[model samples]
Target: MKPSLQLKLSQHLALTPQLQQSIRLLQLSTLELEQELEKYLQENPLLERMEEEYAPPLPGTNDTDSDTAEASVNETDTATSSADDESWLGDEEDSNYQSASSSGSFDDDDGDYQDVQVATTSLREHLTAQLGLMSIPDRDRTLVQCLIEALDDDGYLTQSLEDLAETLPAELEIEPEELQIALNHLQCFEPTGVGARNVAECLALQLETQPADDTQALALNIVRNNLDLLANRDFVKLKKLIECDDEQLRLAQSLIRSLNPRPGSKYAALDARYITPDVVVRKLRGQWTVNVNSDAFPRLRINSLYAQILSKQRGSGLAGQLQEARWLIKNVQQRFDTILRVAQSIVDRQRQFFDHGEVAMRPLVLREIADLLGLHESTISRVTTQKYMATPRGIFELKYFFGSHVATETGGACSATAIRALLKQLIGSEEQKRPLSDS
Candidate 1:
């Protein structure tokens, strides 16, 4: 065996530190981006947020002379920063600040933000409060409280009496029969079906409390024995089994439908998620336009005084920090630019959906946008993940516009979302006596 060395010329992609940071900032959601900016502002002495009064004019100035001068100064600064190892300070002078404001304006009439307080009660708390008021003996009350704690969020007692009995303390010396009795008493609590073991049992428990009548008795019998038939909506079979006419069966069904399946859910704690959209879309003149939400982003800039002081010093670490701060500013601008471009492309492609509704939404894929905007599919995915747009209809996540394609009768394709919308409309307007089938 022999080893030989030869020179070969090839190229492979490598991401620089600044480039990696740019990519990371590009994909962060609005809330995450704000937090990242805050961290940088605290850690980096060169970076500071621009006040409202000091905000510079927007980018892309129409002044040709100013643009040329700015370009020359930038080039000179770049060369000096690269070549001078002893001192970053140079004889050349240039404007110290760059504009950080985005291209569009926000509506000043949107009103002030207010904090809202929400009051909520959990299912367990509601049950315990009711249990505390019972006049029963302390021992039986203890057993009932055990069963109450065992009930799930949906008010269904999923654990069997045997299982619960085995888990009881040996000192209590409780039996399965006593636990069953406690469960029965617990079932009698308000929100009628709290301790039921299953759907049939829950419905039967509610039905038993209804006033005695022929219809009530028949409904109870159907729920207790033929709950499966009722769920399948086999009216002909149900009519035969229950010995009732169409009118009576319909009335019974209406009664059954009025019963609550999840009685304890009303008492569950409220989990409200607040969404702040990254883009606001509206009709301008005769065409639709997009604007990045200024309120969601912090206005950041380099400190001019620090930069001036650092320029006069020789061989200081502040130069690297200054470069990092500039990179951060440029990266932030690029992030918003990419987002705005992507948002415009979406609005253009989904004009029909905006004009009509979800039924008019077209079939879209990440590749389509990626190819249109010269971006990677993974980049498109990241951009759409947690970003949202506010439209005239409602606010929707960017991912909501892209869906699988379904073939139509005319050999054209429809989005699965549109198909779902159509199906929902059909079901909603269907006649109860003759419901529409899949065909």
Candidate 2:
């Protein structure tokens, strides 16, 4: 190979600082944007929020109704502001649940302790606690604990006894029969279905504890073998299988319905997330209209003092900060503007969805909205990623309106969402004695 230097002309797009910021702000969800803004507010002294001030009612508005609503909101804002000033983590509602003050004195008139949220006991912990008091050999207790650890969130043993025995130390000589005994002891523990191998066994374990009767026996047989038939709501097959009348099958099914299918799920940890819709949709004059949610973003502005000082002192160090602040405010506004544009485009395309239900949803895609709005497909993708819109039907992610299409008998197409809605409607409306078939 010859040692040579070659130069080729190439052209590429360069992202300017402002364009980068715009892209970043557009991609962030409403919650993330707020957090990012909080970071900028802390770092830049030249940027500040324009706190909303209460405006007097317009001349002809209902004074009493508006005033009362305004007063309550103001009171809540005042209390929240004070609490935040004291401590950022403090809540205004903490006073109700707080039992003692800083001086260690009770706040309540009665001496009863204020109830606070207690930590949840996981499935393993609950079973182990019950195992502690049992009068059994340590080896048996250890085996029971091992089996308890194997139970899943739904309290079913997904692994077979042979499989589990294989996983144990070979030198210990653990047998499937021994494991079965340990499982029996475990089933005797509270939450009767804790060690069940399947749904049928779980229901059977619970039913075994109840006094045996005609209904109990029939329910047991159904759960043990015909659970699938009952789940499909095939009352006709159920009557023929159980060889009983409608009243008898009805009572047996009622008994089975009262049993919990997932016993350990109650111990699972719960996580609650709150979502703020980015836009709201409403039907106005027989047409769906989209409006950006004002509360989703903060009203921001440059600090007036810093701006005036910078204006007078052109060479001040705050010039860069001022420019950054202006960019932040503009980019945030543009972000919401982009969201409103995309949401309105979606609602316009899927207008039938708003008029009827999900069954009326027409096929749509990002390309359509992108071409219609003269924006890139990637830009529309970012806009609909996590942004939510509130409509009369329910709050839905903006992306929900766009889905894969299914060809219809007519030349047009229908959305997969619409197809699913149709299926659900058909299944729901089918007769209970004879449910709809897949064909």
Candidate 3:
């Protein structure tokens, strides 16, 4: 074949970094946004709070002189107003953002450390707790720790016993029999599927622990040899191989679906990071109103004290400090402006969904919104990724509004989300004995 170059016009999805960030921000829960905000504040120090309220002076003066004085006072007030004031352009609440300072810290007095606990004990911890129950010598316990560390998030051992044993010194040799005993003990932990060598073993461990029956036996057999058939429901061949009829095969299929595929994952893969809902939409008088969560966001003001010091200082120090201060203020303002624009766009696109239900979700793609806002798709994606809005329907990720378009049979496009809503409704009304299989 000869190589030739030709230009063709077509559309394709390109995931840019800004688009990725928007998508990520759109999906972030309330807790995550706070954490991000905290990080920004730590890096930038020009942002400070205006704690003192403004009070007007007494009204009394000669006409021309008083007017000039009043005008000057008004300009000063405009320049140094609180964040709650209209002139203040920074985000509604910068302090609400999660930061190391906001998060709990070590108490030297109590000799204790405290941090926001994002997740409960992981799968490894659960396995180690089980090890505590067994009467193992310190050497074997150390080996067990190494083995536990080798297990993947799914609780399958990715390392061989020899590999784990080799990590220890030459004198502290681990026998296969002792290693086998430790492995056996580790397999019996809660969540049923921990410490298996592979997926087949994982399923088998669960099956062995469950109530015994022919269905269980056949399902185990299916897991062992004919696991590939599980994907497309090729039960005819499965029936032939397992020597079971149609009804028996159906029962086995049902049993297998109910099994936990990632047994260790339940304990291990809970959200490592939490999110903070950015925009809160509450229904009032049958209409939705959007507000930023401001519980912890205190008003920020240019520190008059710092500004006075800068003004008095004569050297290069003042110039550097002034530059730093201006940058800090500008960044904070930019962060808020971006957040507000993104939040408003979300409200505009998802208005119908918020008012009605999931069925009313629009066919909004990140590219469409990014084009409208004159921003890179990746930027929009990051902004939307982990951000959320609380609607009358329920709290939803901002990214939830932007779904891939599915062509309709008649003419116009439909959102993939709308189809999923239909599917969910159909399934809810379906009979258990005969499922509503996809066409």
- lDDT (CA) per prediction: 0.75, 0.78, 0.62
| lDDT, model 3 | 0.62
TM-score of each: 0.56, 0.60, 0.55
lDDT of 1 by residue, 1-439 (tens): 6999989999999999899998899789877998899999999999999997875543322222121110011222222111122121122211221111122234422211111111245677767888888888888899998988888766888888999988988888899999888987899897788898877788788889999888888889888888778777788998998899998887787667667655564454445445677777777677777777655446789999998889899678899889999999999888877877888899899998988898998999999999999999998988888788777787778888899999989999999998889899999999999999878
Stretches of model 1 off by over 4 angstroms after superposition? 1-3, 56-272, 432-434
Model 2, span 59-170: residue lDDT tens:
2223332211100112213221111232312333333222222224366533323222112577788789999989999888989999998887767787899999999999
RMSD of 2: 11.7
* Candidate 2 TM-score over all chains jointly: 0.60
Clashing pairs in 1: none
**Per-candidate count of clashing residue pairs (backbone under 3 Å):** 0, 0, 47
| lDDT, candidate 3, 286-367, per-residue tens | 7555655443122344557667776787663546545655554444444444655776777777778777677887798888
**lDDT score of model 2?**
0.78
Candidate 2 residue 332 Cα shift, in angstroms, is 2.6
Candidate 3 Cα misplacement greater than 4 A, ranges? 1-150, 157-199, 205-219, 226-275, 282-289, 296-298, 316-322, 429-439
